[model samples]
Target: MLDVCVITGEDGPHTALVISAGGVVSDAVAPPGTPHLRPETITLLSALLIGDWAVADASPDGARIEARGIVAAYAQFHLERSIRSLGHIDRTE
Candidate 1:
């Protein structure tokens, strides 16, 4: 699951700041396609997901604001799975 927000630049293009459960962070064109995911809002989300990364100039949506909790929950869930999977890597021998 991906927690994404659609933010339109002052000029017009939309961009998303995304954070993965495994602690990956990046920015990209909003509504990512194919296999890529979108970004999160510029707020506590970035801080919660990563230590120093920050979110900036994100569009404010009341609907999306509420989703932060849900997204965080899922991200944590995924993170747990990722940790468990790492155990298998060591056993792959």
Candidate 2:
């Protein structure tokens, strides 16, 4: 149940790449001509998502950066969700 979102650029839309033990699902909403992620990139992202630092660290610089960016975006998204959900908590005694 690992979800990774990579922010392509300031004006570009984000791409969602989901990886599960069962299989991989991608919501790549990029422009028409945009290329899909490379296999190495996916491997690096999986390693980063599952906390396999050895594999992640051994990846190429570009792949590592891309994967880390995706991981960071995913973390930020979850953090925002957590913060928003806090507003729904019952605070009364």
Candidate 3:
């Protein structure tokens, strides 16, 4: 199963969303912080995905938590997202 994490962080009025696919995908909806691309998010995401944190109960809409788990790897490729989205993404506005 492809567990996907829709990480949406906000810096003041600006917001950035990063969707990561891993095991036990989770969503952390807390007050967003400054917009910056760091490995911090990937590390947190890995912990959530591997630990099987409360993703299943937390998401129920188009979002979901898969039971099969995934080979959680730390991937922080802003360029990839940008290219894939056709320059539709950025860490900052």
Q: Give the winner by TM-score.
A: 2
Local distance difference test, candidate 1: 0.37
| Consecutive 10-residue window with the lowest summed lDDT within model 1 | 8-17
What TM-score should be assigned to candidate 2? Answer: 0.45
Model 1: runs farther than 4 Å from truth?
Answer: 1-15, 21-31, 34-41, 44-74, 81-93
- lDDT by residue for model 2 over 43-89, one digit each (tens)? 77668668999997788877755655555545557565434454474
Better of 1 and 2 by TM-score: 2
Which tens-of-lDDT digit does each residue in 1-93 have in candidate 3? 122333432222212232342122222542345222223333444445577566434443222212111111123342343224423534231
| Superposed Cα deviation of residue 89, candidate 2 (Å) | 33
Per-residue lDDT tens digits of candidate 1, residues 53-79? 333224345324533444554556766
- Please give the CA lDDT of all the candidate structures: 0.37, 0.51, 0.31
| Candidate 2 vs candidate 3, TM-score winner | 2
TM agreement with the true structure for every prediction: 0.24, 0.45, 0.20
Query: In model 2, what lDDT does residue 5 have?
Result: 35
| Model 1 lDDT, residue 51, Cα | 51
